[model samples]
Target: MSTVYLVGAGPGDPGMLTLKAKEVIETCDVMIYDYLANADFLKWCKEDCEILYVGKKGGDHTLPQDKINELIIEKARTGKTICRLKGGDPYVFGRGGEEAEELVEAGIDFEVVPGITAGVAAPAYAGIPVTHRDHTTSVCFITGHEDPTKEKSGHNWSVYGQSNSTLVFYMGVKNLPMIAENLMKNGRAADTPVALVRWGTRCEQTSMVSTLENVAEDAAERGFKAPSIIVVGGVCSLHDKLGWFEKKPLLGQGVVVTRAREQASGMVKTMRDLGACVYEFPTISINPLENADEVEEHALQLGRWDWVIFTSVNGVKHFWQHLRNAGLDARQFGGINVAAIGPATANALRDRGINPDFVPKKYVAEHVVKGLLDLDIAGKKVLIPRARVAREILPAELTRAKCDVKVLPVYETTLAEESGAEIEKALEEGRIQYVTFTSSSTVENFFQLVKAEKVQDCPHVKMACIGPVTAKTLRDYGLTPDIQPEDYTIPGLVQSILDDK
Candidate 1:
């Protein structure tokens, strides 16, 4: 906790993480985070960093405030950098100010990093602006329930009720009746518009609207709990008209994305955009090939081949790395035609100073072969720079066509490790609704870590494969894919899942 960084984990989306917060997280020696902090942030920590969970949810505190403060002081004495991460803004009813006072009393150096709080963000996500020129000019933020440890309450209902302002209450679900009564008794209108938004900014975000006179009763009937933001004003009336939340087909659904780690970010965002809680489980780890000299030697003799085929971006990247290491560039390819399996691979080739001569509409072995053979490569020498263990259909087909084909290994995919027990627990707890496979390797590697019976036992959990090839791999393991797109692409796969739901 030496020079502790009191950082804020923004309202739900990992994409909202600040540049400085990301830098601190990546370099911090210890991460003292809470439940509201995105679990994805943990993956950014260094392998050797120590992590402590001090989550406080509803009345369930994993570690009490006294113990957490003591733990931070103890760790700070060791001169290790500590990231004291909290949900939303540390100063926005998050008890961050209290913690900072304690740190100051202990003479610990600290820095505060602000975040997007639920107060402002939740209303916006629900299509209710806290301030409107026609409605109110000012806004008031109050804790629905004050600290019980205090000798007296700090709320002045008389002045607050008399003011013409928007009222927002944090953690107000349980105290909604008391708050409504206090405001009404102090001269505020009982029939004012009010909205309750729970788990704001997340895929599980839900909101209900009513007047202050009836919101509490309605919330009780609906069983809305704490951790909800209560917005009371004319702005609440805008929710029904401006909100598009109901259109999200995958809302509150949990999706597990299994792909190579480096390639899964965009996929994760896409799944979340569909209003699903994404669990990024990167089953495959892409690394350089063990045979560096073999790849380098092949790079020096590219002129011997009539065509060079790159099946994936990894192939293009790894092959180009060796080509540069051998003091050769794309200009060295004097007479060799370049072929890419998909647009992504073609883009990767173009990034490295080579424009692919041929790219198929469908990214499959058969389609690639059909497109290449259309260009008349009979009896030609072909070199494929690709994964160490890949489907041999392309090479085998060319060999059958009386062409010399050499499959050169450029990169390899290995299994990435995570807590299998935790994953099983998430599935058992009904937090996971879908498991996605983007490639054959991802499907194979996922089964290697997770038991087939665990997946089979969860009737609610559906398997989603990107295309027919990946689905075939899942079928080989005796599991049928519940969702597969006819277009055989990432966007199409996601759309198919939404359509199925």
Candidate 2:
């Protein structure tokens, strides 16, 4: 039998999309989505899959209810994998119940994949628990919009009003006046706590708190728009203390970090935990060097060298790959001393069970050179296998110390793919609140990926350069840096963004 999967598109963030939802979306042949469904979530769909926009936006309806229903049935009949994706929980405010009923009447096989509803999701994102043991004992889910053509009169507010349950209304902004007045008329207190959450669970989310009698007016004053939720009852009063999303360490700060993907992973995890959303735009993509015949041929000659130095993790990785290619392993360095430029590179070597004998306390190339000079290398042989763009100071200093040093280029740097559309769309829609540039190369390469034509039109999205070099690059690109760290490290850049606030 044919199937129509009615899946819920969780509120805004693609991260909130369930693993099951993501898996099905990846395999679906065709996906029908609403305007409110997060577009980023659709990126999970197979590249060749057809996407159909079937819901209304603002006052314009792309495809009416009847047309959308017919489309789903027709697609299912074709034996294609059809997905009717909706924003939030389908059965909640989404006319999903009506659509499912229609499908059942027509003898169509349909299944609903529940999603995180906006009413519950919004409050949770704001760090307010919908149910609290000390406050609300029960919660009532209600609608804000009622059928206009339905025969006359207000809903029986008394039934829910007297229950003392926390009432949450979905799509209730437009009819707030009538709903509030009717509730108060029945038995609900005018002073009942109410909250309006707009763009819930998203970076742009905003909220306002007031009493039942004046919530509508207060929401309007705060400019709450559609795709919002109205929650009522005592639980609303606890938001002031429970609001935690806004309290993240790097909540509104934006920093740019330029490090290789492998090296950048640790820094990214650290920044994210501190409440900062890091935008990864790698300036220099690392690629293996063109010719390594000489480096590979001299692999066992490592014992002839007094020291084998690695400047970056890429250096360690590429050198190791070459060693394996030549049927050599960590044991080849038996009599040779090992050195790494920093702790990160040292850990990379240590992971291979070959701990470096020495590593610079500081991470810079100059520091590595200074530290090596402190060690006795007179009349000794040293091997430095690193990136083509890596500094020559280490080898030069070793030579100055009367040591024979061989510099082998292990990897090369290249620019990453263009991100013009992403940056442009993010700026136009205000999706990206901040951007971090970790290196001068990243600052230049990111702009190269972005169309300069659109940059001038972008609104006030904050820009942060990780260091002076990156800051100068941004200035050359006709953009002024908002935050620059005194130190050129990932944590330093992150701290700079936080310090700005």
Error of 2 at 151 (Å): 5.1
Candidate 1 deviant stretches above 4 angstroms: none
lDDT of 2 at 28: 91
Task: Summarize candidate 1's per-residue lDDT along 1-501 as a digit string, tens digits.
Answer: 378888988877677778888998999999998888777788999999999999877689999988888888778778999888888888898788888888899999989988888888888889899999989999999899798899988999998788878999998788899999998999889889999988888888889999979988999998888678999888998998878754578989999988887888888888888789888788899999766999999898889999999999889999989988899998877788999887778999899888889988898888888788899876799999999999999999888878899999998888997656767888999999999998999988888888888998998899999888999999998888899888777788888888888
The candidate that achieves the highest lDDT relative to the unseen native structure: 1
Query: What overall lDDT goes with each candidate model?
Result: 0.87, 0.77
Best TM-score goes to which candidate? 1
* Pairs with steric clashes in candidate 2: 255-436, 256-436, 256-437, 256-438, 258-438
What are the models' TM-scores?
A: 0.95, 0.81
Worst 10-residue stretch by lDDT in candidate 1?
417-426
Give the C-alpha lDDT of model 2. Answer: 0.77
Q: Give the per-residue lDDT of model 2 (tens digit) for 1-501.
A: 677888898887556888778877988999999988887667578889889998656446799888988888888888888788899888888889988988898788888989998878898777567889987888878878776778974566888677678788887888888778877888889999888888787655677789989987887787787878888888888888888766676653443445656567777667656655455556568888788887797785777888888877888999999999899999998978899866667889999889898887666556667777778756688888887775466777778878888888877878764355656675676556567776666676777777655656655667777666668778888888888877666677777767867
